[model samples]
Target: MMPSLERASHWLALVCRLVAGIALLALLTVTIADVGTRYLHRITDGAIALRVSGSVELVSYLMLFSLLAAMAANVEKSQVVVEAFSHGLSSNLKNRLHGVYLLGFAALGLILFIGLLDSAAAAARHGEVTQDLRLPMGPIYYLAAALSLLLGLRSLIHALLSAVFGADGEVSHGE
Candidate 1:
């Protein structure tokens, strides 16, 4: 890869990681606040209008963003693995198999990315919005599509590296 492209990829990955972290923190905060507000409202006989509107929709979107944003990093680290049947394989075979698996995941990610683009376009055309908050869904879907594309590219790169360099290319966590 060109140095500039490599740097860009690194920055994108970092941004995604940051987004994931923020989403998780926001999700936790929102959950706690929502629960607390509901409890207070119940005990106080509805004296305080502290119940957050559209919280459920917000949380759902946050969870989706968090999961999507973390995909590239997780793929790079080789965190998702199927070990049920591969425990007895030789190291060399295992690495090759994993490379193949990553390639498959890349293909799946590509499909998802394309599908998400179409979904986003359709949502925009229809002016679809969250039921409670009326927040447009198109932009969120576009973001997810972009992240999925990134994940697909990352997975493809990792698969190629693993195929070429054997065990050195893959990040193994002893799982």
Candidate 2:
């Protein structure tokens, strides 16, 4: 990877991770608030009827975004290697194999991004909205599609970098 592209990927990864963290935090906060409201409502004998309306919808959306937002960052690492089988292999080979795996992810992400863009357009045309909150679904689908595009780009970049430079510090070491 070139220095500029590497830096861009690093910054993008940071941004994606931050987005994922924030989404997860929001999900947790909403879930806690919903549960707390239920408990309070039960304990107060109908005195406190306050509830986070459409919490399930909120949680499901948040969870989807949180996971999706991290895909860009997670594509670089998080490989599962059953070392018992192939620990003896060369690191370059491992990196190349990992690159191949990431290539597959890149393709998958691109496919999903394209599909999501189509879905977003369809939702906008149909005037779709969340069942409980009645919030427009077009924006949500568009954001998901954008994130998937980012994931695809990141995966493609990482795949190329890993394949060409080897992922085990070989780039820096000139190996």
Candidate 3:
């Protein structure tokens, strides 16, 4: 059961990473096209004024997705570690400290998840939409909330495993 869960989590993290990468690429493409179009319009004196409507809103949402998708993998990989002071600690001590740090991360992720849920509820109730695209904000908020919940769970699992099995507690997903 534990192995299965670990495998599932690993797959989830991989999917998230792929999604983040795609979102980032899409964002880059949109930004480049928008900028190039505007530049061409400027230079051409309105002859080739091909502006993408609602591009700012689209880019903002893409950025949000990219950030949310990458967060779980980042937590799982312990990529955000701050080694300012504990760099020379013993492996056991470091693992313990990392466990504690992961707990803290879980707490923060929980807070964000709750906040996103609240924001989603409010947005749904208020019929909030992007100014240009009129895209409903509630769905995006809810998706982010879900991803944040996953991140929190991942962090908590990592914390518990680290506490019980030390730094090498992490199960490789055949990667």
Q: TM-score: which candidate is best?
A: 2
Q: Which ten residues in a row have the lowest lDDT in candidate 3?
A: 162-171
> Which of the two candidates, 1 or 3, achieves a greater lDDT against the reference?
3
Ranking by lDDT: 2, 3, 1
Tell me the tens digit of each residue's lDDT in model 3 across 114-157: 99999999999999997899989999899888778878877877
Question: Alpha-carbon error at 99 in model 1, in Å?
Answer: 1.1
Off by over 4 Å in 2: 169-175
How do the residues 37-147 of candidate 2 rate in per-residue lDDT, one tens digit apiece? 999999999899999999999999888888988887677775667798659989888887777778888898899899999999999999999999999999999988888
TM-scores of the models, in the order given: 0.82, 0.91, 0.86
Residue 36 deviation, candidate 1, in Å? Answer: 1.7
* lDDT on C-alpha atoms for all candidate structures: 0.77, 0.83, 0.81
Assess the local accuracy of residue 159 in candidate 3 as a C-alpha lDDT between 0 and 100: 78
Off by over 4 Å in 1: 1-12, 79-90, 170-175
For candidate 2, report its TM-score.
0.91
Show pairs that collide, candidate 2. none
Best to worst by TM-score, what's the order?
Answer: 2, 3, 1
- Backbone clash numbers for all candidates listed: 0, 0, 0
